[model samples]
Target chain A: MDIDLILKAINITVIGYIIVFVVLFLLYLSFYYLAKLLESQAKERCRRAGKNKCAEHDKFSVDSDTTAAIAMALYLHFGETHDIDSTKLTMKRESKRYTPWNSKIYNVIHRL
Target chain B: MEGLYRFLEYTGFANFTFGHGIMIIVGLVFIFLAIKKDYEPLLLVPIGFGIILGNIPFIQNAGLNLGVYENGSVLRYLYFGVLSGVYPPLIFLGIGAMTDFSTLISNPKLMLLGAAAQLGIFATFLGSIFLGFNLNEAGAIGIIGGADGPTAIFLASKLANGSNGNLNLIGPIAIAAYSYMALVPVIQPPIMRLLTTKKERVIRMKPPRSVSKVEKIIFPVAGLLLTGFISPASLPLLGMLFFGNLLKESMVTERLAETARKPMIDIVTILLGLTVGASTQADIFLTKQSVLIFILGALSFMVATAGGILFAKFMNLFLSNENKINPLIGSAGVSAVPDSARVSQLEGLKYDKNNHLLMHAMAPNVAGVIGSAIAAGILMSFLL
Candidate 1:
């Protein structure tokens, strides 16, 4: 019931909220700029790769068989090691059962 | 006849009060909500059962030693984890292990929204002060605004009650915090709808840029140092949180991280929930102050949700059209984590089924945890 303590708490609230906001705002600024930098770097890499491909074509134009062989190699490498078309990953149940937890219980019963 | 009378008086039937009956009913209601309504079953089931066990009255300092208040009792040992503020940090460690901070790192501006949501904590502190709770008590009550049950319990354990059992507000404050956290789905969506337009809800944000592993690893360390310098009092909570994140992100400590998130969290939760429930003896719990704390807790959640949305809307004024935020994601800035984020996703889907806000909402959701811990540290610095 101390008035002084209550006044102190009010002070803490003001100072505290201000400090929290400033710290987070600074974090936001740093992160925002970091993301921007990353985005630009990614674009730079893509552009460089595009230019390098053009340079390769200009320097030594591969014949039809050579191009076919390179394409086949790429297709094989990608087919074995990569997810071609780079689709967005999803998380959901695509089951006929409308409710999963309930449906699974019935399935357990039937299985048994 | 005197011996028989004494034995009868010692029986649970003789010791049981009407308050205990009411508490049992309240506990049943919680259980029902957990089972039928599917409301935070992981938390509620243990807590509800503990409430039942706690209210089964016995003689004071009996040989059975079943009471949470009794010294050398098993439940008391578990309850000590709460009173000593041990379990929450451990819970934070588990939380950090499970959390993917890439979302927050990818869009750190949303971290500001999390900070903005903490306005509710301070607002409720003032309300609690006006309602005649002491500064310590008010601070504990205020943290419910963070919508983080463990932080609320941790802070309240340290602040609301003294080292000895004088003026215990931990029961009320912890319950209010967890109750409000569990009700995030019901409480947040209407406020979100009220604040934002359908057009705003349907707005799609650009996919967040993939964060590098190095950045993810650096985040926890840098975040700890930044927060530690600002609020050293929060180190116990933040240290564990960031440490757990490091364990997960480092990839080398996969076993330690896996155990911390799953088994470790589950075990601590059971102990923490049960102990917290048992602490709520009707006499200690059903006070005028307890009622005020619950009222303030609900108000705190509303204001915190509003604060985040308003801040996001304010930020939108300066933002380009493509850079603008969906105000629904603002509610996720409260520290209820995936639930609040899920609520945002549900709201977004209601407007546009193809709209998926979960990943975007997660940025603020995780940041809200950090924000609340920092707020707690701030309160500790001032009050403790």
Candidate 2:
């Protein structure tokens, strides 16, 4: 009930906010640029792989309509069934422990 | 006739008080809400049944001990998880295992929105004091702003305990916090809408950049150092959180992460929920102070949501049109995780279906967890 106590609470709010902001801001600066760098490198790797290999990697902005259309087309053609190991003309890059697909966690989050 | 009278005396029907009946109704209402409304049913179901178990009157400290308050009872052993502060950190461990930090790693700036929302905790701190709670009780009540049940329990366990070792306020505080969490669908959207305009709600944020595995792996380590350096008291909660993330990101520890996220979390949640429910016997729960704490708790959630939204709006002023954040995502900064973020998504969909804010909202939502944990740590340092 004391005015001083209120002031203390207010001060805690202000200072706490500032500290959290600064720490996260520091993370923002570091991680933002790091992500940018990693993205650029990924793009470069995609380019090196050839224009056809990762056409969608650089085009991350594909609209949901396009995605839905693609999905519908696939669904119609495949009739809701597909063989897991159907052979197709494709080349392999070296296997790695962590790709977006294989790490098996993206199933947990909606990327799009 | 004498034996029948003794049996009747031993039966709960003979000993039940009106308070016990009232608490039973409270427990039933919780169960009904869980089943009908599907409001945090995993939590409310166990807790609701536990409340019934708690309020079942029996002879104290006797061989037929069924009361939670009675010594040498099964419920007393379970309640030790709450008293000893074991279940929460383990829950955090599971939360860490299941949590995807990619949203946060993608948009680190959103972390500030999480921090900004902790205003609710301090705001409620003062509110509780003015409403006549002492310093310790005020701190316990204020943490309801975290919208996080475990942190609230941890803080209440430490702060609200009297010199005589009485933990009088933990029950109401936990219930209030979880109730607000379940009501995220109700409590957050209005504050979010009131604080932001339609245009702001409809604004689309760019999809977060795809994160790399190495970065994801390193994040928990760096985050641990940064937050731990700031608040050592938060280390137990934060440590388990980061440790679980490490197991998840390490990839070699997939089995461990799966175990932590699934079975470990489920077990801890069951114990934590049941004990918390049982702890809410009407004698401890129906106090005038409990009412005030609930009121302040609701207020804290509102202020936290508004603060996050306003902070997002404030940040938008500095951002270019292309980079502007939807202020609706700001309300997700209350650490209710997928629920508040889901609210943001639903509210955004109400404006423009194309404006999917789920991923963007998740950044601040998870950040809110860290922010609230940090706030809890800071408060513990001050009050305890």
lDDT of each: 0.86, 0.85
Scored by Cα lDDT, where does model 1 land? 0.86
Query: For model 1, how does the per-residue alpha-carbon lDDT over B168-253 read when each residue is reduced to its tens digit?
Result: 88888888888888899999988999999878888877666568787789889888988999889999999999999999999999
- RMSD for each of the candidates: 12.4, 12.5
- Ten-residue segment with the worst summed lDDT in candidate 1 chain B? B160-169
Residue A84 displacement in candidate 2 (angstroms) = 23
Instruction: List, residue by residue over B1-384, the lDDT tens digit for candidate 2.
Output: 999988888877887888889989989998999999999998889888888878887655557867666678788899878877788899999999999999899778898899888888888987887887777788889999989999899888788854444447878998899888999999988788788887788898876766779899988998899889988888889999999999999999999999999999999999989988998777767778888888999999999999899999999999999889999989999998789999988999999976777788899999998988888888888777
Q: Write the per-residue lDDT of candidate 2 for residues A1-112, one digit (tens) a residue.
A: 5888777767776776677677667767878888888877887998899887578786666443454467569979898576676678788886444566555674444354
- Top DockQ prediction, candidate number: 2
Where is the poorest 10-residue window by lDDT in model 2 chain B?
A: B161-170
Task: Give each prediction's DockQ, rounded to 2 decimals.
Answer: 0.21, 0.25
